[model samples]
Target: MMTVIGGVDADRLLKDRHRAMWALGDYPALAAEVIAGLGPALVDAVGVHPGEHVLDVAAGSGNAAVPAALAGGRVVAADLTPALLEAGRRVAADRGVAVDWQEADAEALPFADGAFDVVMSCVGVMFAPHHATAAAELVRVARPGGRVGLLSWTPGGFIGQMFATMKPYAPPPPPGAQPPPLWGDEDHVRGLLGDAVTDVRVERRTLTVDAFATPEAFRDYFASHYGPTIAVRGAVSGEPERAAALDADLVDLARRADRGPVGGPTVLDWEYLLVTARVAGGSTA
Candidate 1:
């Protein structure tokens, strides 16, 4: 049932199910190998400085959180999954940085208004299911004139197409769930954050990925390690033909996107949207 939490409309059941889905796969591996650089990149973009209050929403395994902490900001890494939080703790510990890890729903972040100086997510908050709510929460928690930064996969990017490819085989999305890739669209995000923020700046960036040796290898890796892919595979597990078709489609997507030497390892340039804005009002101390 949908319930208002922290003044935001949130579906408890959907949040619970989402937590479970994210906890299923070996997400730490995926984060460490595929998108480890995003956190630092975002932190830098937001100009995180020593002793600023920073919040990393939907920070799976503390990707951005650890880096923020390392940069000397007082960082809080909040996510829906406890397992991921624990993993993030270990990561921070290993890096010799301290971060406050908490379980938090992106749509209903448990924080006071203007609680942070910099609110950021590295390809994280875009998947909150309710884009407008999540976007509002991001704004609400940032002090006036504070920064809000986000990195999300573009709709035309490899990851976006992969999600699209999985939709045909996966179960119906829960009510109020917006397509995550919409976060990458500049107009969509500006509309979501309308009139609440100022100095909105967007940059289109590309991340080079070459972790897989082949398209088939990329497909197999995602199937085994990515939560969304694993969930889709499970949805079609009862039908071998459907599962096989998905496998083929994933390979085709990767192959088509690959821009590597012929007969060489797979190389893909994943496009993403980087957005940074300031909450409209007086500066925070």
Candidate 2:
């Protein structure tokens, strides 16, 4: 049992408290969908044979970690956020299973080289500020024949289309609004991994995530769960007021979405992607 490295500071706790509150209101249903975002493809990819060591980066609330532990693998779930990790620990306890949960940054993993048989993230690495470094770290901690997998959102799906909607909220996006590198292009993905990746495969999957009944639904969720991070980032870049402005803009968008077809009880859409790749020299690769 490796010692877990996590401590909650006042700011982190406060930020996460807000994040939890936002999660309660924003996309609660969709959060479940994100839990099931990869479906069976990811579990199969992990090849979770009993006793194998696995590391799940950006494990969040233990979505992938749960399955890995249930499969009898000795697993560690690491994430940068403390609140999420605590939530994961509680979840593991509730399920009557044991998993090592750690608060660690993916870019600076604490494990030794080749420490894990498999390394993965459920659409997490794609969102890292230093993604290439993080990908290399995933490959670094994995053994020679180890497998690395990523469950990312595909471009042009319902989720992709939603990003297009987000653009309007930050029109002339707040200062320092840079385009995301992985909006939906294979080339962007290739650039992230470079050549250490011998084989890369992507499978499309459908996820009916109920984001919001209206655009306002979306805004409410984003404002709450994702709000603190966005606000800090925007504020740090001198766009301090962008958060409220964008929140307003997003609410307006949701109002427009209310007029969308199939608008009732909730907003639903099919959006998700299962991406599998290996860090060259794998027995299977």
Candidate 3:
């Protein structure tokens, strides 16, 4: 199960790490609270119709999948982390919606080609180690004339800036790896889709998270539940001062970025890229 990309065997060396990172905390809980409303928004944007075969790739906790199912599409929720897929199953069950949950890698989906009428990912897929491979897989599994929708963090957005804040302390990405934020770029997204699709459209949107009372609270929550923050904390655990400094810097970032009134609940605005495209005819595998 070795997927070679950029001269590196990512399946052997990176996929496990990616899975472990996401498995660290209850991402479902965090995602439910922080990304509330985004799922439905994406579903609506994609115009998921009843009886359509929908696949939500890298579908963390069934966010988009549940909504798609609710909209009457036959949904399949797929992710690399089993725990996340399980969480998605629970969500589907609770909502009285049926979704086929699959533990599958975004870079290499387990489904057949041209299997779905609509393929969607919300704040997912971009994290895949091999961006090009992941993108191709997305296009590959979608039927010709089908639609693909994705929501990704823009490089200049707040969340992207937060990652930048932690970059100095965190190890650099794998050699030759494309940064996830590139998915946010309209031009880059066009390049990734290439001639596989048409009627490609990219729109910028903002999502607001109002879970914490202050910037410090926001920082604490992320440090505890967000995978990247948790990893960064562990990476600097042996160096107490470094960890503290990193925490302080993150708090400052939250404070400066907060758009809410001072002393009010922290309402952070995150800008993202929303992409929608129709798979071109004759591109089906």
Best by TM-score: 1
Per-residue accuracy of model 1 over 1-285 as CA lDDT, tens digit each: 576768765577778878998998789989999888888889899889999999999999988899999999999999999999999999999999989999999998999999999999998899999898999999999999999999999998888999999999989987679999999999999999999999999999999999999999999999888888999999999999999999999999999999999996999999999999999997744
Cα lDDT of all candidates, in order? 0.92, 0.63, 0.88
RMSD of 1: 2.8
**What is the per-residue lDDT of model 2 for residues 1-285, given as tens digits with 9 covering 90 to 100?**
222236535434433443443334323233454445452357677577788898998777777887788888798998776667777888789878799999777767999988988888875555555456677898899887777777766656544554554554432532222243262356666676677776677666665545455666655565555533345334435555665665665566445434345645354454555656666775763
Each prediction's TM-score versus the true structure? 0.96, 0.72, 0.94
- What local lDDT score does residue 67 receive in model 3, on the 0 to 100 scale? 94
**Candidate 3 lDDT over residue span 1-285, tens digit each:** 455878877655777888888988668988888886888988999899999999999998988999999999999999989989888888888999999999898988998999999999998998887788999999999999899999999999988898888888887777657777888888988999999999888899998877889999988888878888898888899999999999999999989888888678988889999999999995432
TM-score of 1: 0.96
The count of residue-pair clashes in candidate 1 stands at: 0
* Shift of residue 239 alpha carbon in model 2, Å: 10
